[model samples]
Target: MYTLAIDLGGTKLSAALIGEKHDITQRRELPTPASASPQSLEYALAELTGHYQGKAHRVAVASTGIIANGVLTALNPDNLGGLNHFPLQACLEKLTGLPCLVLNDAQAAAWAEYCLLSDRFRHVTFITVSTGVGGGSVIAGRLLTGPHHFAGHIGHIQADPHGPICGCGRTGCVEAIASGRAIAAGAKHDLRGKDARAIFARAEQGHLQARQLIARSAEAIAQLSASLKALLDTECIVLGGSIGLAPGYREQVEELLTRLPPAFHLPVYPARYRHDAGLMGAALWCEYCAT
Candidate 1:
């Protein structure tokens, strides 16, 4: 049976058909609606799912934010344009006419990555540093979603007590400093209004300020990695998302991780599924649950 996998992110929406073998096809993408209205997301989802009428037997979604009881509550409202409390699973079921399964995007990715590393590590943590920072962990060969389905939100952890306010109304969160949104928000003068990607390009050109901005993000992630190791005793860390997989970002994080004590040192590998980890993981979860 084919599973319709959807990845909902701050910047884009993607849907694909995943075969039982875990191969993906007919993938489609659209920019996320910039509007905060619920109707915008509904329409966008309808349009996205409309492309495939009978392509799959079940729907699986890996979405940003907290997914509890078939609903999505955005911790950082800015990430999803202020959309919160959206009925993600119910809406998708109605659109696709198939039972839906939804989970935190990063959590879903963590499961996919863990499956790949099952033979090597019993404990693995996956972190994504894109629009916002997020994380999921596989501990003792099981994915940890916690009781409230909010276990792996590493981005909300405080990196600096006096740092800038997060969109979630918290102060000094990792998301406020290390996320792509944070990187863009931190820009000034020449880099003002530039997105993270543009700043990264400039950084590659030897722009000192651009390099500093990215370095700040890397620093936060490194600290977060160390904290995860301390808390979870994860055997390894898998870094994902656009910023995590960037040319030098992982190297920077590895270097910073080296600054910690030997106990905190763990190998940091790039996400093998890359950007599709969320989608693939969601599909894998669907298959796992459906059977």
Candidate 2:
């Protein structure tokens, strides 16, 4: 079966046609609407799928929001403005006239990561530190979506009581400290207004302020990883997304993890699928469900 796999992120929308064996083809991408509203999302989806009218038999979506009973609502409203209560699955089904499945982007990515090492560990966690931090957990070989489909929303966990407020209205959320957005926002002096990538580049060149900003993000992630160890005892934590995979970033996080007690220092690995985790994960999940 051909699956029309789509990944809806904070900054972009991507779609691909996936063959039965999970090969991707005809992938396309577009910037997410500046003002993310229900109407804008509908328009975007239309434009994204316009060319593949008859190319797929089903649709699978990995999206940046809490997806419950086919409705999409943001845990952090600022990430997806005016997208609260959007009928995501219904809209996709209507748009494509195909069966549809929707899952949280992080959750889907975690499932993909889990599948890669299912023989090694029955418990796994995946964290993606991108524009905003996101995460998911798998325990006893089962993905935990929770009753509200919010089980893996780990980025909202508090990192500092006095830190800047998160888009989710929480103070000191891991997302506010550990995400790419946070890294960029934490810049000072000569690094002002630079994005996370630029800051990382500066850090490589031994820029003090840039290094400090990256270190701050890494520290938050290390703490978060330790907390996950205490809570889930996950065999390993897989880090993905732009910031998570950035050069030297994982090393920084690992070094900080070494500071904690031995029990909190779990093994950390980079995601295998990289940028395609969400798209491939959504496709894999839909296939599994259909079987």
Cα error of candidate 2 at position 68, Å:
1.4
Give the TM-score comparing model 1 with the true structure, all chains together.
0.92
- The lDDT values for all models are 0.91, 0.91
Per-residue accuracy of model 2 over 206-245 as CA lDDT, tens digit each: 9988888989999999999999999999999999989999
TM-score of each: 0.92, 0.95
Model 1 C-alpha lDDT per residue in residues 1-291, reported as the tens digit of each score:
888899998778999999978999999999988885788999999999998888788899999889999898866555555578889999989888888999999999999999899999999999999878888999998889999998998899999999999877889999999999999999999999999999999999999999999999999999999999999999999999889998999999999999989999999999999878889999998887766
Which candidate achieves the best TM-score against the true structure? 2
What's the TM for model 2?
Answer: 0.95
